[model samples]
Target: MSLPEPRDPSGPYRISVVCLGNICRSPMAEKVLTGELDRAGLSGAVEVASSGTGGWHIGSGMDSRAAALLRAHGYPTDHAARRFDPAHLAEHDLILAMDHANLDDLRRLARERADIGDRLRLFRTFAPDAGPSPEVPDPYYGGEHGFTTVLDMVHAAAKGLTAELAARYGSAL
Candidate 1:
């Protein structure tokens, strides 16, 4: 199925990127998407936030490797870890899960909401080169290269997502 239409074209199109631990993938995705949105000149019209399916790192800062990778690539590195709340379904236009497991977690959490299926999606769905793998791998325990790899994946998806949003709400931007 296709993505749902933007709910509030005139207002901010909110998005939430979710991963297993907020300290890693999701925060990186959030910064990349936000930076891409800002570069596309939709900074004020689109807002991107991030959280985790688990609450282990809630209130913690992003992993040093992630923050370094983002800053090295000219993206924002300011973010704190948070748990993905079910209430985010109401506040965000889209909720992108980094992996299928977390996507499943979000789907189960969103079971009570009628439009859950419409807003929830895999983050890598937007990446043209994402290929058969749809999940953004967790780099928490990996070496430095892993963080850079995640950054590359997030960057591609962020650009694609920005284009999609720009097409839908270019006038507002």
Candidate 2:
């Protein structure tokens, strides 16, 4: 079945954070964005989630390092890895990818479809500063510091995303 569209008319703003695998960046983005909107009193106004370009991590929990970093930062831990699908082009209004390869992969996956390329967006479009970056940088292989930096990036982008969506749809919904 297709993923449900977000319920908020203003929009649940269905967003799916995507990376090479769901264990690292995308999951962090999903959880971080969820928390950011909640703290901003914009919770449930957006349907936020995460996935991977590949299925390697499907059904796995967030990487232990990722989980620890999130807990360290006081974010939620509910996550399950899944692969990106073509139907996702319709499932989510926005898809934030972690890097150039994944963004290309996502678009390639939707090559037969129309409208999704526009929906597939860089994960950093919502960053609070530094203009924009090409990638969110995968943190699965490094130490806590890499994970921490990922946290910083996702957190920055989440706020910008929240504000932009709120502006278009009115955050009150």
Q: How do the predictions measure up, each by TM-score?
A: 0.94, 0.89
Runs with alpha carbons beyond 4 Å of true place in candidate 2: 1-11, 171-173
Backbone clash total for model 2 is: 1
How does candidate 2 fare on TM-score? 0.89
Write one digit per residue (lDDT tens) for candidate 1, span 44-95. Answer: 8888899998988888999999988888888777877889888888888889
Cα lDDT, all candidates: 0.87, 0.81
Worst 10 residues of 2 by lDDT: 1-10
Question: What is the per-residue lDDT of model 2 for residues 56-99, given as tens digits with 9 covering 90 to 100?
Answer: 88899999999988998898888889998877788787888989
Give all candidate RMSDs, comma-separated: 1.4, 4.2
Q: Against the true structure, whose TM-score is highest?
A: 1
